[model samples]
Target chain A: MIFDLVIYVLIGIGLFFNILAGIGLLRFPDVYTRLHAGTKCTTFGSIFLIGSVILLGLKMWWEKDTNGSVLALHSALALVAILLTNPVGAHAIARAAHRSGIKPAQAVIDELSEEPMNVTTDERRGGD
Target chain B: MIDVYSTYLIVVIALSFCVILAIVRVLRGPTAPDRVVGVDTINTIVIVSMVAFGTAFREIIYIDVAIVYALLSFISTLFIAKYLQGGEF
Candidate 1:
């Protein structure tokens, strides 16, 4: 009974975040900002959503269901895959946006590009 | 026992709304990266919803399908980003 309630809560939380992410994608301006909505929220939501599945599997296992073990283990692997890939994909998209000449909304200067140039300058001065 | 059919039905409906919103963003996005991000969001949501449905149905195969979908989606996102950046292959 308790586990069922917990699963409900987790699903509720996860669904809420995922919905927020979708809205963020629609409402936020620019690529990077949209990414803030699109990437982070969904990833966080997946943590909860998938976590519920993991808990379910554990619940089954506790009840001595043989399939519970496999379900829990597989769900964990899927969660790991999501954890690993989602952020990296987001980062890559952000970098691509910057490189492809898509500037942020109301931004000043790009510090990332300048940082490399600054490093080169320091190296040149040190050589002198 | 939980009523999974109803539970997942609601969840799927909610996520479909999200996907529609993302599609709106994709359609109206001012820039190319904007569209790409919209597409990426859509992809993520789709994968999660798939997993949710899998659990609702208690299907092991759907879980593996979700994992594979995630991997393929990641690779596609990376490639699209690379294309956008105009970086070497």
Candidate 2:
């Protein structure tokens, strides 16, 4: 009984934050700000979402259901996949946005602007 | 026991909310890459939801689909980044 309650609560909490992530994405200004809202918020929410699934699976497994064990284990793998990939993907997107000339909102300084040009001829060709 | 149908309904509704939020970003994003980020977030959220649905429905196949989706999305993200970096393929 207690376990089911805990699962329900965890799922609810996860759902709440996932919705918040969407809201933040809508409300934030600029690409970077929106990325901040969209990526980090969803990642945090997914932890709980998947965590709840893990709990559910474990419960099923404890009930001696073979399929339940597999589901739980596989869901855990999926969670790990999300945790590893989401941040890396976010970083890539942010870097790409920066390189593609999407400047941060209300920015006063860009320290990377001081770096000397390192563009090879190949890059110059590719840029065309 | 809590009603299983209710759990699935809540999960679907919550995920739909997320997808709609991402749609706003994709539509309003000023830059191409911003839209890409929105899409990527959507992809991640969908994967999680797929797993949730799989568990709720007692179907393992959906979980497998989620796994594949995660990997393919990662590759797509990398390719997009490479394109933005102006690097050779």
Candidate 3:
């Protein structure tokens, strides 16, 4: 019964984060901000939602159902896959967005695009 | 007390709502990257939904499918990003 309640809570929390992700996707000003919403929120949501699945499987496994063990272990693997890949994709998208010339909304200055001031000092060959 | 399937149903419906919102972003996105963001969000929501449905049904295959979906989507996202970056590849 406790595990069941925990599952409900986990799903609820995941749902909230996912809904926030959707709203943020629409409400945010620019690609970066939308990416912020889409990436982090869903990743957070997935952790909980999938975690609930794992817990359910574990609970059933505790009852000695063999299939439950399979479910639990596989869900863990799926979670691992999500955990490893989501951030990498998000980072790639952000870099691509920047390279494609979409400036940040209402930004003043960008240091990333600027050349460093002391290139000659940093590289002795530049001075020579 | 809410039954497990009922709770899963509620959760799935809520996630569907999220997917719909993402679709709206995809359709009305101002720029290409914004659309990509929408797509990526939808992909994630779908993967989670698959796992949730698998749990509700007590069939582990759906979760396995979701794992594959996550890997494939990651590849697609990377490729899209590469194309967006406009480099010699």
Ten consecutive residues with minimal summed lDDT in candidate 2 chain B?
A: B1-10
lDDT of 2 by residue, B42-77 (tens): 998899889888877888999999999999999999
Chain A TM-score of candidate 2 vs. true chain A: 0.84
Q: TM-score-based ranking, best first?
A: 3, 1, 2
Off by over 4 Å in 1: A113-128, B1-6
As a whole number from 0 to 100, the lDDT of residue A38 in candidate 3 is 96
lDDT of 2 by residue, A24-126 (tens): 8778777777778777888888888888888777877888988878887898888888889888988888888887777788888766654665566679899
Candidate 2 Cα outliers beyond 4 Å, as residue runs: A116-128, B1-6
Q: Model 1 clash pairs? A: none
Best by lDDT: 3
Residue B10's lDDT in candidate 3: 77
Per-residue lDDT for A26-85 in model 3, tens only? 899999889999989999999999888888888889999988898889988988998899
Ten residues in a row with the worst lDDT in model 1 chain B? B1-10
Backbone clash numbers for all candidates listed: 0, 0, 0
Candidate 1: how large is its RMSD?
3.5
Q: For model 1, how does the per-residue alpha-carbon lDDT over B28-58 read when each residue is reduced to its tens digit?
A: 9998889989888888888888877877787
Candidate 2 CAPRI assessment class: medium
TM-score of each: 0.89, 0.89, 0.92
Model 3 Cα lDDT, one tens digit per residue, B1-89: 77876688778889999999999999999899999999999999999999888877888899889999999999999999999999887
- The DockQ scores of all candidates, in the order shown, are 0.79, 0.62, 0.87
RMSD of candidates 1 onward, in order: 3.5, 7.3, 3.6
